[model samples]
Target: MSTTELSLAGSQPGGLGRYNRQAADLHYVTSRVMVYLLAFTAVSVIGFPLFWMVICSFKTSTELYQFPPAFLPHDWTLTNYRDLFIQTNFPIYFVNSLVVAGGATLLSLVVGGLGAYSLSRFKFAGMRTVSMLTLLCYMLPEVLLVIPLYLFVVDLGMADTLISLIIANTAFTLPLTMWFMRSYFNAIPASLEESAMIDGCSRFQAMRKVTLPLALPGLVSVGVFSFNHAWNEFLFALVFTSSETKKVLSLGLATWIGQDNIYSWGMLLAGAVLVTIPVVLFYLLVQRRLVVGLSEGGVKGE
Candidate 1:
């Protein structure tokens, strides 16, 4: 055969070799696609209820309760939202939730960050033991602590106040906040603090200037987590407060739910959708910090 013909012939694969290679590539691509498809399917399945409720919030009362309840409304209206704003204390509940969650989250950051710093940096007798005990506190159920907390709040004259809820939520959230902050801080070098000390910076100033900037992402994660816990908290609010005016968004939703008025699904859904906006905004804003913190959060303490 000619050299050109031979070269061309050699370039063509035997059927079995080509088939095997093609099959292997196909298998790899198929598996990767399958993994992605499964994850997307799972998310869609999980998200469908929230999606349906949000869409239903735009429907009329008659349309919402008709037979099987429409999946997508033929007649979308603003009436349900109008009624929700006019007839309910949703705005008040929103404000109450914001204040309590904001207060608890901020407190957790300050207390937890300091505690985490102490635990990570200073070695003293019973430090490990104290940390272990705090870790246990993280596992302790809120329900178990309810009676004592209720009595304590009542004694302190804060039983129905937002401050009472903020304190209770902070107590539980602090340990978790401490652990995460400690882990993040542990990843930082001790010399950074020592150098600041050499430069006439106090321990507090060192932490405030050098460490705090680096640890901010961790602090943001801690704050967002604590805020979520305080905002959506139900049991304590349910048990501690009797006054409707003191009710949070979580408790207010339950008040909207009555046996005789199941047709208020539109109103309920509208409220739910409204409640989600602030949290979604929060997540969007802090999402960048979360990525940066968690990325650098794992390293051995020097």
Candidate 2:
């Protein structure tokens, strides 16, 4: 071949290689931009309502009703929160919600951890059926179960008490906790517990030391779920309790929605903001564990 032709051929190959590299770099940059855009959109969608709620809570009743609602309050005030605390029974409602949610979360974790351990470790007749039935119970509508549960509570003489609310919440949340924890337990090798037993630990001790620690993520996830559910629940709170003192945050908030009288938008918004704070704080605290737990639990189990 001629020397000029040979040089041109070599240059063409290098030029083509450069084009391919440029194309790949462009593609990577485009993908990253798209992903970031999508993430920003999602965060804005989820966070804007919360931001609005917090902002409006600080607004006066007059400002809240003004045309073309302002994004930021011109006159920031604590009157709504002050009224919620002093003029209403919101503190009592907050305490009731805390008590019920905390009790239910604790009950669910203990009972669910033990039950999940049993279902994970033991193989017996109808074990699969029992597990399926547990999930089915969770899937049952709240309205369907309310009457039966109310009747049960009445019979036990626990009606109109926080204990009834706790028991009711536990009943609803326990199944999900058991199913989720069971997956975590099944992912953990039985040999680890066996090894602990060989080292003079009792079965319960082995569980406390070996199994529970490994399953911490799952526990955090379910504890958060149970607490969130119980804290936000309104149906059971309405049906099972009648007194103002026994009311929870959800029911208490509903009282502000007047049939004949005007709604207290400021106080209502303030209550909503307060109601959301604990769940947000709890999630923020355990978010790392929650993410790991959900991913591991879903992927590792049979």
Candidate 3:
């Protein structure tokens, strides 16, 4: 008799299960192929407009209005970009946007990181309530708060001030950032914090040396989220800022269109392309860290 162990409890070793296994493997492969195809389709649909806008940016105004649309420029020109620079306050709006968004992001990361560390590491009365309420606060829509926020800023004579915009953006961003960071912190073992504390480190020092380094990805992710929140913000800036010099990109871009006529379509598309580049560039720079942040922040990661 053969001495080798029977495979799959069949009469023969390593050969009894071929027919069923082969069919099942083929089905699994087919399913995976379908999944890949579906994902590719979804990605293509989502990215098409960005590609279309870029193509439109290079087309002449007359070409842009042509029927049946052209994907490639029959006659491309830099006129739109030139007009954007010369005729619009895009430069100041870009600078204001840079300052306001950068400042707000920095402020949110600082406050939120500290709050997250505290909430995750230390226990206190009403802590759970505060955690739950913080998320609820983020859920409070920007539209709902715009009226009160505008009144409050105007009363302080901060209308059109970048500081007002920065503060408002930071306030809107902080609660969510803290919660995101705190969830990440919760996943990190408390023992790590304890070890740092024992090694001549204050709680803050421990965070700086031990926790923060490990949580850099989470930091980057939250930073990206906060940056995007502060950057694209429209309603607050619209209602609060009135001066041409103070306007951010989202509002400033509106001036490209006149009440009576559509502005240069090519130039408008060009402006959009320029506005999109920075955020996309920022994400590309930090995408690796952002992935780590999301994965590490949740309990899903070890």
lDDT of 2 by residue, 1-302 (tens): 36645565567787775676678679989999999999999999998998888899999888998899988999999998998798889999999999999999999999988999999999999889988877777778999989999999999998899999999988778987888888779989999999999999999899999998998877888899889989989999999998999999998888778721455789888988899889999998788776665554344334
Model 1 vs. true fold: TM:
0.85
Q: Give per-residue CA lDDT, model 1, range 107-177, as digits (tens).
A: 88988889999999899999889777777787788889988999999898887888888888887778878
Q: Give me the runs in candidate 3 sitting further than 4 Å from their true place.
A: 1-44, 255-262, 288-302
Looking at model 2, which ten-residue stretch has the lowest summed lDDT? 293-302
Point to the candidate with the largest lDDT: 2
Candidate ranking under TM-score, highest first, comes to 1, 2, 3
- What lDDT, from 0 to 1, does candidate 3 have? 0.83
Error of 1 at 132 (Å): 1.6
Error of 1 at 71 (Å): 3.0
lDDT, candidate 1, residue 10? 72
Error of 1 at 251 (Å): 1.0
| Tens-digit lDDT string for candidate 3 (1-302) | 12322344366345555665677679989999999999999999998998899998988888888999988999878998998899878889999999999999999898888898889888999999998788778778888888898988989989889999999897778886888888888879989978889988998788788888888877778888788888899888888898899999988887666731546777778989999999998888787766765554333366
The collision pairs in model 1 are: none
Give per-model CA RMSD: 5.0, 5.0, 4.7
Alpha carbon lDDT of each predicted model: 0.83, 0.87, 0.83
